[model samples]
Target: MVSFKEIKNDLPAGIVVFLVAVPLCLGIAMASGAPLFSGIIAGFVGGIVVTLISGSQLGVSGPAAGLAVIVLHAIEGLGSYEVFLSAVVLAGAFQLALGFLKAGSIGYYFPSSVIKGMLSGIGVIIILKQIPHAFGYDESYEGSLHFMEPDGKTTFSLLFDAIRYVSPAAVIISGLSLAILIFWEQILSKKGKIFQIIQGPLVVVILGIVLNLLFLNVYPEMALSANHLVELPVADSLGGFFQQFTAPDFSRVLTYEVLFLAGTLAIVASLETLLCLEATDKLDPYKRISPANRELKAQGVGNIVSGLLGGLPVTQVIVRSSANIQSGGRTKLSALIHGVLILGSVIAIPGLLNMIPLASLAAILIVVGYKLAKPALFKSMYRGGWNQFLPFVVTVLAIVFTDLLTGIGIGMVVGIFFILKNSYHVSHTMLTEKTPAGKEKYRMVLAEEVTFLNKGNIMQTLRKIPANAELEIDMSRSAVVDPDVRELIEDYKNTARSNNIKLSIKETAEDEKLEYEGMKF
Candidate 1:
């Protein structure tokens, strides 16, 4: 259904996104402690499978760096990679159920401060974890999102270790790679179409290969070992590629641990999808809005297929989506084509891809980490005052100290408490004055919509009246009032009469008797 003009625009963008995704796919997989092919499988399913059913014009889905930490621990906790795949498969089914229930809007319930903190926290972890790989001191493993290393070193100790065991060749490649990426992002990409089209990551990877080759020949001691480069499985034939695909372990499918993990994956993945879809829509020049629930279902299916094929869980990732938007993609065809390109490269040119150094990818991820936890973001959050700053800091610290879900949970608790505390202070207006005949008059004006959450303040106000006070409760402005508040009012009436306090209701809720036990209270 796409026009030729759209195709023309989308094709080049697709290529650009494909170039961008290759390294990220591999890097995220490496960071997740999963097989490199799993990341490719995720991108393939997210792009090709998800896009087909998606209502979004320019959303791109894949293995996100944000989920890398979860996958790493999930694999470790479950004790088998195949068992974890079963969790991922069930997670997709949960997402499908959520989509059917139209729970996509649940993502909006999270506060902006908390969400930003989560991203910032993840960013810090990424930079910290990638430091070892960046400097070529990757003795433990390629993937770790924790401060504590698998080999009994804390994050700071690991940094010291990295300095002690730094590889000159790795330092050179990664340093140069970071330079290229920064130059391309900040300068070259803005100068001309050619630079933008070629993409910095792709250029950096190619340069990394050329530089490594130079080091290998001209200075053997400076050369990166085979372990420092991407080690994608090179297939000799088409069938060999198929042989690499793995199936989930059904034996663990019905376990409580798998189900709980599945639920966690579903909720997190769906939330990330909703957030990315919203951002993508905003970035679209055409101002098209994607259907939230439909996108959830699409992502659900994508995860299911990916899990079935030994892929990591997938989400509508903002990085590739933004890349697509910036590159002028016009349709989902771009995403579809990008997925095709990924599959083709893995099958046909994996040898060339294998030449790309992990240090180059380390540089790319460092930039990503910096962008997420920029100093400017911290300054802005600080300026938003204690309510915002406290949650933000708590979430960031909790994530660095604990884990993603636990950090988010702690942040959410703080955010909800602050919301309720603010609500209690501002839910209504209270006035007290001496009326004629020396009687103290009190008036409580209810807010436009009052819920049970307002009970604490309301109850306090009602109980504070003295025996000689004249009180009037007004609800003329309120459209809806909770029965809990109404009952509190009814309870106050008895006390009013017994204490000889003059009490009158200017207006109760609209149909107070009817609202007490109806479809809505």
Candidate 2:
């Protein structure tokens, strides 16, 4: 059972998480072509609704960055943003089916190296993506997807634009906020338990807002624009509350294009959620296992809520989960409280939040990215084995050059390569026997599930077997053999006549061949 001590310990962390999430929720929504309010809705559902059903104690769910590309394309293809909400609802239904079918186990098949690489790759991307925004260079929106200028300008061109066009107020606020966040960790944490207990990110957010307000009032001309802060839909009364709900254009959802978009969202969202869940569990402080199937169900529920309320699809996010762990979270209550805090802040203190600078949020993400790409992470994987390193590197490179799915697919291939490479090394054996009668003997055995890769080993073993011997072959426990292995065995049998060996099968049957044929490749 979860303890109150854990809950109490998590309060400070929850507050920090809420602060970090607020801007991100809005930024991701903005990037996805959805209304800013939709991001808040997703954050709320992820924190409150998803946490209730999730098996993970620390993982926090929200609108995922990985879905940005898909969401962007979907919105454009669907003609209207409201029409895409129907796809979101259908995607949630698909995820629910995946949970019931216990498909979450698929996450376990990913190699540790590949997962680590993916995380690191994503970390680098986050840092790169946020560089412009952190400096208060708000060009082409906060979360721009296209590497090249949307209008054919290069990345260097965009950087030039930012340098020339950045607002003085935004630069000052961002610089100051980043400075405070940096110093807060170094100075405050050394003071006492209470100071250390409070997260640096939270301190930065609070200070950023205060600074914004002070700057705005004192020097209105030099102040950052209203766009810098989170834009929440503040509702003062009952009627205003109901107006927030965004209804779906269900009439257009049955179109072929809509159906394809729904399928894409369902598959990608489920995959990314499961991936985050798996990675987060590995990073858990207590080394506990989370129920992936349950996570899927919870995420499905969250997506449904988000879809109905004009929010994007939700997924378990590693950034917030790691922050939850780092911030001393002991239970899922931290996540629940964060959700409450999000709703309360938007309703009661949006004016206060509006003071926060985008750079401050970028500072938090930079730190998160560093944690995922820590030097020790690579060292640890190397010490574990090369089997892990190859896939991990492949995943990282693939993600950096391509996208999430492409990177993961490449990593999987590298992982399979290692698996087969390892298998071939220990999978076959040939023995030579000596008898008083001067009749040489040989024994050959092939491992179960032998593939073509194992042929070299099998042939090498066969070549060492003595001639003029009574040969005994073992296939009793072997399940399946590749065509290469069959060819090797048949070749050996044919050559036995010249070798003067009496070949005998220790175990063989017609049924065995049929069973082997039925086995998976």
What lDDT does each candidate get? 0.81, 0.77
lDDT of 2 by residue, 338-446 (tens): 8989988887788777767886777777777777778888888888888988788778777766667778889989999998889989675677767789777666676
Which RMSD does model 2 reach against the true structure?
5.2
- Global Cα RMSD, each model: 5.4, 5.2
Off by over 4 Å in 1: 1-36, 57-59, 64-87, 140-144, 148-154, 248-265, 275-288, 318-334, 432-440, 462-469, 493-501, 508-521
Q: What digit string (tens of lDDT, one per residue) describes model 1 on residues 1-521? A: 32455776788778767766776787678778888889999988888999889899999999876677778889999999999999999999999988999988876787878878877887787678678778988664443445565456777787788899999888998999899888888898789978766767667778889999999899998999888887777888999999889899979788888998999889888877886777577668899979999989999899899999999999988767866876668899889889988888899999887787778777766776677788999999999998999999898888787766678779989998899888777668989999888989888899998889999999887788887678878887888889998999888777887777777776755644211111111
- Kindly report which residue stretches of model 2 are placed more than 4 angstroms away from their true locations once superposed: 1-4, 140-191, 213-222, 233-238, 383-385, 430-444, 460-473, 476-487, 499-505, 508-521
TM-score of each predicted structure versus truth: 0.83, 0.86
